[model samples]
Target: MDERTRADVERAEAALVEHYPHLVRLAHLVLPPSMGRHRKVLTAHGLVQRALPWRAARRAAGALPAQRGPDTAAGYDLVRQRTLELALAYEDRRRPAVLLPTVPFVWGLRLFPRAGGADELALDQALSAVPAAVRAALGLWQLEGLEPEAARAVLARAGVADPDAALRAAGQLDRRTGAGAAALLAAGEFDPCTVHVRPTDLLRRRQRARAAAALAAVLAAGAVVAALPGGQPAARPAPTAAQQALDPGRLLRTPNEEWVRTSRVDFTAWPPRGRQAGDRRLLGRALRVWAAPPPGTRIVAAAGTSTRPPAEPPRLLYAGLIDNVMVVVFHDGERLVRYAEPEGATPTLHFARTDNADLATAGALVIGRGNGWQRYLIAPWVAGVAVRDLLAPDAPPHGLHLAPDGVTDRIPLPPAGGGPCGHWPATELRTSARLESHPAVLVTDLGDLAPVHLAYAAAPAGPAAPGEANGAPALHSWARTACTLRSLRGTGVRSVSNWVYARQPLPEGGGTAEWVCNRAETWRGPGRAMVQFEPPAAGPADPGRIAGRATGTAVCGPYGRGVLGGVRWQAESGTWYLLAAGGGRVDGIDVTGGVRAGADAPTLAVPAARDAPAEVTGRLPDGGTVRALQP
Candidate 1:
């Protein structure tokens, strides 16, 4: 039976390899060009990954025989449909301001490359003008060959209000774009007949690189390690008597157990500089777009230095807000700098080379707050530090103490005291991580901290869930678990600057909220540690009650996994209420509420119950009588 299961898995894996690129192309066609091709590929891959579980579940339920392989076509269709749904939801929040032309389809075009020719450029321009929803409809119907009814279903799933209008707009877009190409397409005279590079071609390229690296590691395993990306680390001068007493590693630590810091960096040091009156105007616009300015407070711009502007123009820094955190983007000629700041706090900077030839290669590093501490997400090239003492802030600083088990010589990370920049340290380097290639280097001038060089040669890709090989905790798994424990929802990987602005629905109200996620983290104060752990406050003066019928079902699986499934709800109470499910000692409600309702709520818990539906209830703040019927 085990052998059969392994064979079945292999079959499923083979199917995935065959269908992955088509899935990616389908995703790209439907999603906005601005989302970038890397994002499209990731979305496509994630959708396909999600489908694998469902496919496996069906096989377990005997929907398919163990000997029979899963249907690749059906799976790909499901993946495409999901991508469309996600695209539609994404489009709702970030509607394109203008329509753009659909670009020329080529087999080997660079991922995320801008349109090159007149035809492709015109297509992008035309498509940009169309509403995102409409563009999605066109991609679904024309490109994916979805029936109108199926297109409507996709739109409906995405909560699009006017699917018909979207379809009409798709037709309108074709008419307005180049008449010759449009006519050819309409006449079915033009077909992009070329097959893209096969998935095996990519696999072979990666395999050859890996084989070469393995051979090199075997040949030079005992040699002196090469310099990190930042070059050879500088020698540290003798520490002062007072400085030597303090551990550099402890600097980034929470003072008195504070999860976050209060001190703000003085942005005035390199005061924002504007070149022209128009630059000042643009700066104001950027501030308005990225920051929530106080009603009447005027914003000003300044320069980083007094020197006149150089002939080679500095890149305009893009700005946006993510979960109230400010994101500032600027590209030096060589590298991209993404700076993030909490409200009124100094910024933390992450810099990476802008020279990624392959979109699949890691070109970006993300530093954002997670679970009351800073979290770093480096691309495959950047390695996490295995330090025994202080190094730098941006290289996996949060879970420093939780290094993978068996790491006896782990290096301690640099102090998190000052923000990402400033003060102390000549050069810090870590030469070992089970997964790292070269050393990870943090090169700084003795005192100046404004722009420290964080450089490390590219590292090989390791298991996404680290420490799973042994019994130790996994970094990626723990990060996700910690985020979920703090009620951070929909935590998943993303592509782009690795930064994306998105909307999350409020758990209580029916209302939705626009926020940022990919490469961003909302800084919630210290987690369970900050809670007072006191009993509920005395009842409010105005009493309230919630009484309703809650007909929900339950199912229990093996291994003590009980689920409250097929649950549906309707609210009898006129007022909003906090709802939860309880049975035995199991707790399914949070302090805020089990599940809050704007006017109604649903069963959102899997409270353990033996062979029965869990008892679900609703309550008001004043300790009012709340009852529910559970059949």
Candidate 2:
């Protein structure tokens, strides 16, 4: 090499060494705290060393004019950009492929703790919850002092189309936190210094794999190495069932035992001649039956950047459990739509696009849980179109006026029972179908476990007799029993309100009246609940006059929709009545499972491959008329 070139390289190397500590600190802020400090430092070192502009300056020596003469500011911005890129890649690779379907709707500043009160743990969860591109955009603009357009360019490099929107959202999130990004670095109640640093060979992992492969090849080729005396390796033992169960990769694919046969609904039967275009019941049933897998299968859902051309690669449109069935829908680029019923192992064609406009631009609607998630073709054309025209195959599609502020097609669904089906209230649909589209599947621990009946034998010598006027004591005993049951079943109890003074609705023409005691709780997996006291005799309902062991549990399904059943004590009537109210909003008519008049009701089963729905008998202690549920 020429003397001038060699000198330039040396100068660049010296500058890099001097700036190394600052670069590492910058990387630490941009990357997840889950990655240990050692790796962060190493990754930062590498990024700085590889920055193209910096590298060019080093190699070309006197080719580029010096900025600020030997100041670290020279090419520092370029180094920061490169560091941001590396940090983004690092975060993307670490994110789990499967995500809870509720994330998009639940997305808000609540996911992040206030930056002023932030610690490593809160920051980690917040970062994991948000899109990596959004996080990177925030890092570039806020931490690296890059301009909005410059940050957008960096985001564009990472395949984010609407960088401005992403940045705006990030800014809003930051503002909502009422704290700057530095809050994540601030020491709070928890000491950041004491954090356990796990050693990782991230940069060398690939090299290690390659070396292992080469060694295996050598050993297969009959190569042997001399070993010192007593240097023999210890024998490794096989993994036990428990160890296998704990393996993180084990649930990537559904277990064979978890597969169940699914029921099918013919497509031709839907949209009855007089049915409205947006019938909520039809929409719910159609999506549920179309997208749901067999009763027992758990769903495995994933979404990310895709290279499939012409239109964007398909993304997860919906993932949820409808009536305990796993349903998943895809926002696909492919013009052909397909459905797979339990009886059919392979998906058959459902809809084929023949319109001049691209169907890829508009997103799809979804209903159901887990493997039962079904997608609704809300918009078949890029331009906005009316629902009736979009659904009619013979009608020419009309142009839709796309909203300017990110909100696109507003496809309204028919309100069944006075409410939209499946509790999905979002009407403003936006397009996130490109490679940047992030799709997620919701998988709960309660696959399809039918809600188990939890009962407590009346405790002796409590504040009041089990059948006495004081209901709090008996309800309290039942609640403890329920808590124990919850613990044994291994389900998480998100929240519980016990024995609070709330009104319980009496059967028949009774108006709302205050109750002496009530209990409720939100649960994870399959069921959530609300507990109320019921009076035995019908007529003017009186909470104060209510007697006997008359407590009923309103069990909710995965998405806060569920059935109201269990024993209702009516002291006045002295006769037991079996009651079952449909699952879903009490105000809405879209009932999932309900019992009217003495008719037989279906058990609440979580669609499980092997577990059948738990049988339940909603027997009330004598008297009072049973309420009929509206479909």
- What would the per-residue lDDT of candidate 1 be over residues 1-631, giving only the tens digit for each residue? 1123433455555655676555444445555443434334344445445433233332365455555555556445544555555555445555444222223323323223232343444455556456668777776766667888888887776667899998888877766555433332322111112222222234434555796998697546434333345444345457554332232221111122111122221111111111221233333332332222222122221112111111222343334443455554443333344445444322344433333212122222232333222322222222333321121222333323321211112221232322332212222233224332433433221111121222111001111111111111112111111211112121211111110111223333434322111111111111110000011113111111112112111111011111111223222333322333321112232222333232222223222222333334433334432333322
- Give the poorly placed runs of model 1, Cα more than 4 Å off: 1-19, 37-55, 58-76, 89-116, 179-631
lDDT of 2 by residue, 363-473 (tens): 322232122122233322112322221112233323335432111243332212222122211122232243234221101111111111121112122112112111334
Query: Model 2 Cα displacement at 258 (Å)?
Result: 10
Candidate 1 lDDT score at position 319: 43
Stretches off by above 4 angstroms in model 2 are 1-22, 25-70, 89-126, 146-163, 185-195, 198-631
Per-prediction TM-score: 0.28, 0.32
- Minimum summed lDDT over a 10-residue window in model 1 is located at 525-534
- The 0-to-1 C-alpha lDDT of every candidate, in the order given, reads 0.33, 0.34
Number of backbone clashes in candidate 1: 38
